[model samples]
Target: MKTDTIKRVLGYTAPYRLNLIAGFVCALLYVLFTLLGPVLIGRAIDQVFGPGNVNYQGVVFYLALLAVTVLLAAAFQWVLNVCTRNVSAWAANDLRRDAFAVLNRVPLKYIDGHSHGDIISRMVNDAELVAEGLLQGLTQLLPGVATILGTLCVMAVLNPFIALVVVLVTPVSIWFAGFVARRTDGFFRAQSAAQGKLSGYINEMVAGQSIVRSFGYEQRCFEEFDKISDELYETGLKSVFYSSITNPGTRFVNAIVYAAVAVFGALSAISGSISVGQLSCFLTYANQYTKPFNEVTGVLTQMQTALASAERLFAVLDAEPETPDAPDALEPKKCEGAVRVENVAFSYTPKVPLIENFHLDVKPGQRIAIVGPTGCGKTTLINLLMRFYDVREGAIYVDGNEIRTLKRNALRGMYGMVLQETWLKNATVRENIAYGKPDATLEEITAAAKAAYAHGFIKRLPQGYDTMIEPGGGNLSAGQKQLLCIARIMLCQPEMLILDEATSSIDTRTEMLIQQAFEKLIQGRTSFVVAHRLSTIQSADVILVMNAGRIVEQGTHASLLEKGGFYANLYNSQFAVE
Candidate 1:
């Protein structure tokens, strides 16, 4: 709705100016030849009613010209469509590429807070709307404007009085279009929002169908879905109703304008101010002049909806991305993995801080185990260490260099991480293991898998290590997936490692193998292991016990057990459950 949004949409056509100009020129020439038809026909009419004998030869000559004009105009109209399509294709491609790239650059918080399905809808659905609108827009706008201007010029030249009547009547149709737009903008916007919500709900239902079935909540899920669907139906009705009325409304106004033009021109002819031939020409031009207004109005009606879609895409394109590194940002060739968190404070939202004045001093090559209850800021701490969110009150330093002053890639590249929720692309087992080190050889991949005790099960499969991983790793056992993740970190050989609830899903037998693999991988590398299972971290060089975003206790596992503090109570409780 903003002038700036319209300006930005039009600016996309600037790069294709030559194509647009050529299309406009073709459209103009087509309209010009179209206008010539009326002139030639008027001449033929005059030839039939002349003072002397009828001029059959002149009429044939004029008819031949008219036929040629029609054919030539058809060729240029084809050219116009081709040129406009080319312009629109390129602009759409540019928009899609930029819109997709914005996702990569935006802050993680944005992605976390918004629904993934709604984001996809904007990128795919709304963006497609904008593209289709651009195509329709260029086709209608350029030719429509040219035809209107050209027809008005011819009409004004032929009969100024009738042209005055047409120019005056034009505002009636314009006013109708304006009224439609005012009534339609809010509906289209609401319609788009409801559609996005429906898509998001559907996506959520599909992904969580297993939970629904397990909990006997099929009816409940359907009821929830129906609520969103009903909202979409209502909004869709309003949008369609308003948009559909535009064409008919403009057509009605156009009919009135044409009737006015005929009546006034008839009076002018009776008064002898305009000749009969000229009057015929004026009548023809009157229709020609107003038809473009009608087409333009229809296009505007369609654009009101498309502009809603464009606004969503533009919002994403304009969102604030991750914070940039300083002017003198560092990109170290290697890191020693000594991380220091100095007075860090952060929160996912305002007025509800999660971590405040948190500090840590980690020595290089030390294995630090983090143990805490759920929602006690354990994962949030790891997020901060990874620089997924910048600290508001303090700085995190890696290898004695401030992380904020280092390029994000350089800072994150030092550590290879595996979270509780494993991620495996739908690729071969070999490709999955070699994700971080893509160029690794088959022997190297096999060796890494062997270290994680995954090479045995992998080789027994139908395709051996070449077996394709299904989406969500649904084809593999949870343990097999965990081992593959471990193998990836082994191949990458990062200076630091983060294992968050890494062995939670593995069976006891596989957990032992995985822990052995972790011991080998953790050797001589600074590692942060977050776990609820106390037995897994008894051998950790240092144990950090956190609660409510601060470390309540910090020491070796044996030393903490001896002190019998909060960590002692947590350790005893877990063992009692076992």
Candidate 2:
């Protein structure tokens, strides 16, 4: 409802304003020409049949002018359509680009709670609705309304009684359209929401098909899906039923008005109150008036549906992005990989804190291991390091300066991260490795792949380094995907590295091969390794054992075992499980 939001949408048309003006002028001329048709036909009848001096040549000339006007109207309409389509496409593209850019700026928390299908639907379906509302709606609604108004004014001048009948009929038609619109708008909104829900459910089912099959929950899933689909169908039917009534009802009203106009016009002609030509013109105008009424109801129905879509799209566009950096924030000139955490505390929600009074320091080139039970904030620590989420209390520093002081891009550029869940795009092996460093040469990409121990198998692929991956790396083993992720990180050659459960998914034999590569990669660089396998970090310079949002044990692996506390208990538990 904000004026600024509407203005912002209109701003997209600035470049095409001239063409739009021209189109509007052409439409007005076209409507005038349409109105002239009835007058010309009426005049021809008068000239041929009246007792007054007749001009057969003039009647012929009038017919010729009518033909020229019709041709001109058609030509102008074609030009208007071409211009409108080009402008509409440009505006839609710009809106899509700006929407995506805003999405990129929004915080990770916002994305975490939303469904992928719902977001995608807003981007694709809602954008198209806006385009239809702006382009097709304007072109059709404006000219149609103008034609009706112009015809009415001319008819009133020709015969007020006929004009009065049109005026009386219009309000009834408009009132009916309003009633139908009021009923259908809510139904349309509900239907769109239901569609979003259905899309989200379908995406979830497809993504989790493996888990659903393993658990034998196919019947349950099918029942739930059917319930959602039924709701969508019912809501859609309600919307359609309401919209379908409006057009026919308007046409029925127009038919009654048409009958009334004909009877009145004939009486006026019989009484000699109006000429035959004038009666003919009055009837033409009456028909023209009712035509737009019928069409307006249909346009209004489309507008209601489009408004429903626009509401969803605006909801996304209006969502506030994650906290932005201060205008005075500075970009770090250099990074040395020295990191410090001072009494850091974080909580995703208010009721529970994930990290309490956490503190750590790592000198340049030092290697540290963070070992903890599941859900003990190991990955959360890395998230803070990457600034994915800011700490609730306390500060994190890099190179003797507060991290919040540095620009986000500059701060993130210092770290190379390899996460537990490896994701690969459908691209060549070399392209996947070079994702982080797009300008990386083929030699550098191959070197990184070899360092991650992925080069050997990659060469044996159908097209060697150029081999394409299927979606989600479906054609490759889990170990291969992990190795490809590692290769991507290596290509960046970041000064600091965070490896979060990087080896947990690979077999022991493949883990050893990757570990050998990791050992070489970690040399002379500050590193933080989160691991479930205790043997993986026996030689770490410092080991921090976390539990329930607190660091319960801290020291070298040997020292922690010597203490015979929580670390020792955890080690014993893992061995017991084995």
Query: Best candidate, TM-score-wise?
Result: 1
Model 2 whole-model lDDT (C-alpha atoms): 0.84
* Clash count for each candidate, listed in order shown: 0, 0
Candidate 2 lDDT over residue span 121-218, tens digit each = 77887778768766766577557778888987887887777888888877888888878877887898898788788888998998789899999999
Q: If scored against the real structure, what TM-score would every candidate get?
A: 0.93, 0.92
Task: State the local distance difference test value for candidate 1.
Answer: 0.86
List the lowest-lDDT window of 10 residues for candidate 2.
1-10
Extract clashing residue pairs from model 1. Answer: none
